[model samples]
Target: MFRVLIAVGLLAWTGLSRTATGADATDAQGEVDSARRDALLSQAQDCELRNDYADAERLLRKAAKFPADERVSAEILVRRGDCFMKRGKEHRAYELYKKAIEQYSLYIPFEGVVERLRAVAERFASGEASWFGVKERDMAIEIYELIIAKASSAKQAPADTLRLAQLQTEGDQKLEAVQTYRDLMKRYPKAPEVPEARLDLARLLLDLAKGGDGDGALARQAQHELDLYLQAFPDHSRRAEAETWEAVANERQANALYRLGEFYLRPSHSSVGAARRYLHDVVREYPSAMSADLAKITLARLDQKGIQEPEEAGQPQAAPVAAGVGHAAVVPPPIRPPDKDLTPEKAAPPRPAKTLQAADQVEKWLLPLEDLSEDTGEKAK
Candidate 1:
């Protein structure tokens, strides 16, 4: 028992000593560490030139002491990462590079390191950066957050913010993803990626509504966003798709209103005027929506005080609306009453000068088919 206690005490003391040494090395022995780190870095470079990466990495590890010049310390970390990467220890290389960004040195390969980290993030997200056959996408999320927060790669921030939100969504952290999406729009409203972010945000809101938006609030938000985006980007190539989403939002709202109206009409909660008004709200606000048609059919029954007949099977149902565009109503031809007049008549009298000329010019031809033409005519008259 005594020996075990002594062994535990010694182990604790050794751990504390190591921690203290690391803490005080920066200030108490700064000069000594600086000289030693520099020499080791030099030797590491010589080994690198000889393509002796195994030895180079060993020297770099020893050279990674506290409080060297920021540039030298950063270089040591990055060089180690490079060696590990060449040795196919990408996971280790990725960790080293991630740490190197925190040194805050201008000489650090900020752009190159950021790009490499970004690539690693993608590999992690795609399940390609696995040691035991599965990669955690949380690593990708952390890397993106670091890049954005550190501004180590400011140019990539907007796009990365969007990607981070998408990954969050896939991970089922939808609410956090929503905030991140909003952050992208607020922080970089003028970015080229903003439009896509806006579209996605609205779409995500609608998706959330599908879960449990009893009052259709999320659907309304989606509708408003789509409205503003469409106005701003009238000539956008995705305008049609955006319009479709807008229509879906509208129909969702109409559905809620319709249900509310139906609820009011139940025998337990009868309110005819309220129900009528709600149904009318749908027809007036969303005439192009499919629910508006339902509202209209329901309203007709309410007004007539009788059950509206079901649609005939032979009657053509409404065609599936085209992106929810408004359709013009076709008017039927009016009936015309038949005329009552219906008769026909009238013979004309012969002309006297023509008859006399015919008799004078052609006495023989003008003679009647019987013996006397003029005499027969006089007898007939």
Candidate 2:
């Protein structure tokens, strides 16, 4: 009786187990359908990579029929957003991106959705249409703010910031662009774009300096950033160009100082001494440059204007500084060499002194003879 009861219990358990297995099989079939949808979503992503939007749309539409698959649906939405963006459908792309993000929020983390949305915004910002597309600028700024808000978990926040900064530059908001670049460098110190941003900021600052800002503040900032770029990207291909610009900046600063000196020394009667000092500074500081040459010329002119430097007390009073005003000592005309063939004939040999004496003596003797003859004629008469 005990063995038969055990057997009966085992049989009942087996039958129940079979029924549960059947249920599991049915559930697994549903899962298989979901898997197929997910696989198709993956294929759609591949099509996007291949730039085959038609096939990608077809696959995504099929994946949408599997309403039970949330992950697949989110992926399809993202891909559809990409397709719309590529096709120049900004409003639709923006809408699709928002939808995708919303769908991803259901299960996928917000961080993942943020990156995709940021990318979508970048596509708009980078395209030529951005110049006229008000929505793109707004969305880009929004994305940047979003990244900043979630910076702690944002993997590509720096990249987003850089794109935003570049867009600002394109929009001609140089000050905002400079600040953004600075912020990016500070926030993402090791980002690859940091060097590029530094270079750009330096250029902008140099331009500011050229615009006549006082205190040399802009130039100082530019020099600092230039140093950063050189230190960071020493072997960059554009290194030569950067160096050239640095040299140009230094020259411009020197020129500005020299011009200030000239302004002071103008007819309005500012201190000539101060003007000379400024030029002297340029010559002393930038000896090998064109600015130094200009400074030297200015210094010479200043000296000629009776500008004097104190000398040792005992030293014989140095010649008074020339008051050049307008006149430069006329340089004498160059002497021409006597043409060998055209030179006057060698002077006739100086008559010998003895010969000259003999001629004088002959004249004396002839005069006496003539007088004697005149006396003789008188006696004969």
Candidate 3:
């Protein structure tokens, strides 16, 4: 019985020692994890202060791998979002911001997020953050879009929307900018920026009309917008500029009509009278316009006799020569007979018989009579 009790006591002591050892190991691991998280957070903060967003993001991600308390995780997300914002990754930053907001909604305030977004916009607007290039500008635009979308009041909404529209214009999103400006006018007509918005919208419409393939409808619309601006703000500072644009729109409309007339005149099936009427209308309605000058010249050309249609016009007529002058005649060289005997197949010396006869004739003419008689006697014998 004594041995049995001693064995049971030893077993209990062994079990207790094993449990203690496991607990101690777990505690050490927890401490190491905590220290690692703290170190990562510190390094990330330093990188952010130095404006090294890439490294800051790297460290923040590493820190995020370890288990963190709710407050700590929320702070980490906010910091990561800021890093993304500074790096011109606004879309990603916005996602992080949303995540941080969700995490911090119960315990922490989100006013800081609003302030941060506004600060970024101000930096971009003031040219303090060098948001000139396409990438940075686009990112800024996205950030402002998010902020504007979340604007709480009428006063905040108009300014943010106006800034967004301006940024869109700078980024070559003309169509979007036009829509934004129109929306601002419709929604906040009495806003401080309404006047500027009206001016910009009119200008954008004119620009769209001036494009080579622009719609005639757009040109007419732009002219109407300019008229409204002039009527509403006669004493406005930009009234003269607005008037100039209105004239430009008028010129564009007249030019469009002139082009259409030219098109009608070009096709074989179209009527010349229709083209003439169109051109005449332009000359009458917009006499001071540049297209009016072109229309007059075209009308004069059309009025000339025997040039009623493009087909009859044929290629452009050569300029008339002087009365007495004509084209210098291009006289061809006279034809010559072919030399058959000098051809490669007939390439031989003069006839042998003729040659021999010529030689004998020369000899008879030049030789003495005695030598000739002696040569003849020898031949007879």
325-352: candidate 1 lDDT, tens digit per residue: 2222112123349765545443444566
Counted clashes in each candidate structure: 0, 0, 0
Ranking by lDDT: 1, 3, 2
Per-candidate TM-scores read 0.64, 0.56, 0.53
Q: Which candidate is the best by lDDT?
A: 1
RMSD of every prediction: 24.1, 24.3, 16.5
Candidate 1 backbone collisions, by pair: none
Per-residue lDDT of 310-361 in model 2, one digit per residue for the tens?
3434433213223521111222123458765643485455575554455466
Off by over 4 Å in 1: 1-56, 63-68, 86-91, 131-135, 306-381
* Candidate 3 TM-score versus the reference: 0.53
Evaluated at residue 335, the lDDT of candidate 1 is 38
Q: Which candidate would rank higher by TM-score, 1 or 2?
A: 1
The 10-residue segment with the lowest total lDDT in model 1: 325-334
